[model samples]
Target: MPTVTPKTAGPDMSSPKTQILAALRRASWISGQALADAAGISRAAIWKHIHALRREGYTIQASSGRGYRLEHAPDHLSPEGVHAGLQTELLGRNLICRRSIDSTQNLAKSLGRQGAPEGTAVLAENQTQGRGRRGRSWASIPHGVAVSLILRPKTSPDKAPHFPLLAGTALARAVSRVCGIWPGLKWPNDLLISGRKVIGILAELEAEMDRISAIYLGIGLNINAEAEDIPPDLASVATSLRIQAGRKIDRLDLVRALLEELEAAYYAYRLQGFGPIREAWKEHNITLGRQVRISSGREIITGTAVDINEDGALRVRTEEQELVTVSAGDVQLCPAV
Candidate 1:
């Protein structure tokens, strides 16, 4: 029987799978002889693998005329498909995906605590108890993206706050590549589209007083959610990419791009720190010049959003000309009065 990759295990990751998927993408149908040559397997072996894939829900149309073609992929999200889609190294090397879960973030944290390697990823097709920053309820409709990543870096624990900033930059790049639309970063980790909330990122850090240990960066993106699927309360505040782009998208493609984007940015961050990504983030940020009222811990401060500090904190210049650095806070963009 073909093995079904665990939700925590992303894709097959075998070199042969990559070659086969790439060939299938280029040509709809190919002869078994050609497949065997490309995959470097015997014709009989190819037949065996094909049968196994079929049992695993892959629709490989086989006949003397058509040879073999992918008619329907399993309604399931295979780690192999995800691995084939993600043409990167290290980032998605450890993948755990679930068909339905309460929270990928929770699962990711458990895995992270167990010393999961860098680039460990957790994905779910549906999250029953998804959470955004500050315990905000996140919607996880079928086929929407609810993912969490575990990053164990050797950076200062103080600098862990910037992980979300880096993630926001990566997300902007990812969304732009797929949707052909520019998304703006708000302050720390919120991805906004036309002043509305489209993506929310929660960065959970586990560390001591001095150095940091690990960071769990969970991202909740509104992908293909119908307007009606959104909660009535968030109807005015939230929007989906499909609703914004006026079309459906290939989830696998977007996931692949996002993982690769995160990988590249993360590599740079660990190598040279947050210089380049921070600069890029500043360029695409919409909150810098706007008026924002921040709810920090208990005290709320209202001011003109000037810039982010080097430590990745939100800086607000108040009416009294005092600038304060906000380490962690909930942001509320004050409407024009």
Candidate 2:
């Protein structure tokens, strides 16, 4: 039996199991009597929480003499695990961890409306009704990173549209740093590794006139999914960090890194403006200076993506020598002439 470590508890973290895990995290194991005394609960109560933790995919080894040791941590995302080594001030200050949910975005939006604090993170192990852009179904995976964040920025609602682009920039940097694999950014909100999609981001604004009440930023990153786990249609287009890196990445570590990067990027935007974010996005993006086709509603325009403007819109030099700035569209690299 391991005793829970004592740390600053998070909101809604009053459960006995959370405390027990915190204690176990501090060390491999403690005596059963020690755990009971530390948690101020009986040995039977400690055993009950231990059983629940095991059910959630944690491999705890309990012996008559050796007490309990954490042989293996859970593959699934737990708040205790994610927050264990998190390094951030505002971002992920309060985290909502769920075993299964319809969508993190939905819950995040609900929480935002209810005035959830800024930087509150909603994470789910599995999302049954996840969504991408244009109401497309986001494919779910067992060990994927499905998280949504709530941000209340002081900027105008006009800047709301650029949040997704900012997210893409942060995401690429985080992945590159954590997994040691550099990913290229597609226009707006897609991350590709070796020209295959690995992450998708969506940002929605809840605004009142010119003021933005909250921004619900949802991100889905393929971390440890096997090839067979991907859909037939997506096999050629999608990939996971595990598949690319040839090893399973620790989701908790990745999550912490991503949140830190995102927070830094957001703060930079507020303090310095969008110039730094735009520049970073350009450095990692694969769409610029490439022959491209943009599909916006009923019209299709073919051009060369030359630049992204200050407002985060894509600037294209069309085939006819005309310049067009596209604020929203699906961009595709055209076949070389």
Candidate 3:
């Protein structure tokens, strides 16, 4: 991840509630008058905001002389909670968080059509109609991470296929930083730890013949789920950070780290091109140099995974000494016979 200045880091301070929270965080307690002056709001408005924060699960203590003190903050992923200490340039600045939604991708696409700015994000605690590659159903538990990002990049439509690889590399870096365990990238957009799937990425694009309009990148990561939370059909193939680490992980910290890393990757790609991201992806990749089978539509190709090209296509060396580039497919590791 690229390093940013303090000016561009941390939560947006323009929000009155965020400003008050920052003030309170700076000190043990803040006087009502002082908070009002700092927030540029009246004392009554300050009180009202304080009440709203309390309703959102912040334990605030009030006293006649001490004013207001923050006792505790819940672990919820509300907009206010996520913005408390989040550091990013554009991503997560304009965020929409929900307790439950049908799909973050759907909401993100809808927002994109409405001319939502690039770097807008939609997050949900649970997704009822979550989807994966090839229109497969994705199971989303409440403890997992379900978020979609809307991006408008000034690039050609031909480069859109590389977005998933970009997202996967960023996610791998973030998970390694937060979980203390490095995950291997399975070609295209899956992250695996201990040979089990931990994260999946999907990218939907809107484009014309030559120009690209919007890209909605959806990411689902298993953060704090247990073995029992895994669906029966997916039990053998899916795993979570908690199951692997043997301890619960903080979702808010992980989400913040993800946004920051993603922002860095996005800017790097825009300025420096896909060379940096491709190298990073290769460093953590597990598919290359292995024998595999890929199913693209009704055709099946069995070959040795050779490399990924600049356009994010998987290069494979078939048994007949044929080198093929696959742009879309479902991959499976073939057992050596």
Candidate 4:
């Protein structure tokens, strides 16, 4: 794994509730007095903080004599939850958590326009109007990870199209670290396991004439959904981490890993160049060296995926022995006849 020197400590953790939660995680049980002393507050204030944590879905058990025990933490994505173990410099430093939202991407874009910092992140538990590539609707349910990151990279506008590939590579690395299963990447912005889509990424760019202003990278990952949670129409083509791993996954861990990996990848691209990312993406991609059919506008071209160029264009070797570079399209792996 690549590493970057962190400019600042990840996520803010000065809140009383966050402090109490940290204490609960450190020991089996903590006395109210002890928590208050640790948090520099009175026992009554500690009780109030504990009550707030419980309302936020933390399963805290209180004994007659013993103080409190954190029995379970909900799988939902929260700022405190993700910040507890997040290790990153730029990404996810200014985090926002919402229970329900129209879309994380929209909010992130709005923040970007208002001069939000480079590492600002917006995470939503449920996205009512999520979107995917080609104007398709992306469904986000509870327990899934729906996040949008605001990145202001110092690069040209031509390089904006490759942001999705960079994000996909980072996500693949994070998933492999968490679930022990390495997912294959489809061209553009999809992660597949057992030939079913599990992750989708969309990159929207705000650019000037020559320089790129900001890139809002939106990612939707299906973490703990069951088979019934998937729509009937997409059941055959989609899956969740729980279905693939046969157990529930911790969303906070996945989110932290993702932010760390993304920070590393993004800085690598900015400082070193795209050589490392392109190679890493190729190692995990299922598109190259396969027979694929690309639908670009009115033309459907069937060919062997030869390579992806530096600008992230897919080069296809067609039946006519002509090599064509496609900038954007829908790719499908063609079965051998």
Query: Given candidate 1, what's the lDDT at residue 124?
Result: 83
What TM-score does each of the candidates earn? 0.89, 0.84, 0.90, 0.90
Model 3 per-residue lDDT tens digits across residues 1-337: 3443223644334577876776776679889998897678899899899988988888889989989888887766877667666767689888999878899999999999999999899988889999999899889954987999999999999999889999998899889898899999998889998888999999999999988999999999899988888888988788998888788888988898899889888888888888888898998999999999999999999999999998999999999999999999999876656
Model 2 lDDT tens row, 1-337: 1111223445344355656765677777677877776567899799888888888888888878867777788776777677655657778868998988999999999998888999999998789999998888998865788999999998888897779888988888789889999899999889998788999999988888889899999999999998989888989889999899889898887898888888878878887788888888998999998998889999998989999998999999988999999988888876567
Candidates by TM-score, descending order = 4, 3, 1, 2
- lDDT tens digits by residue: candidate 1, 1-337: 1111223222344556655665565578898888777777787778777777778877888889767888866545567677764657777678887888899989989988888987889988888999887878887754578889988888778888888998898888889999988999988789989778888899988987777778888988788777788878888888888888888866777888888888778878766777777797887798887889888778989999898888998889999999988888888877766
CA lDDT for candidate 4: 0.87
- Candidate number with greatest TM-score: 4
Candidates 1 and 2, the one with greater lDDT: 2
Q: Poorest 10 consecutive residues of model 1 by lDDT?
A: 1-10
Ranking by lDDT: 4, 3, 2, 1
Which pairs of residues clash in candidate 2, taking residues 3 or more apart in a chain or in different chains? Answer: 1-67, 1-68, 3-23, 4-23, 5-22, 5-23
Considering lDDT, which of the candidate structures 3 and 4 is the better prediction for this target? Answer: 4
Q: What is the lDDT, from 0 to 100, of the residue 13 in candidate 4?
A: 38
lDDT of 3 at 92: 86
Lowest summed lDDT over 10 consecutive residues: which window, candidate 3? 3-12
Worst 10 residues of 2 by lDDT: 1-10
Give candidate 1's TM-score. Answer: 0.89
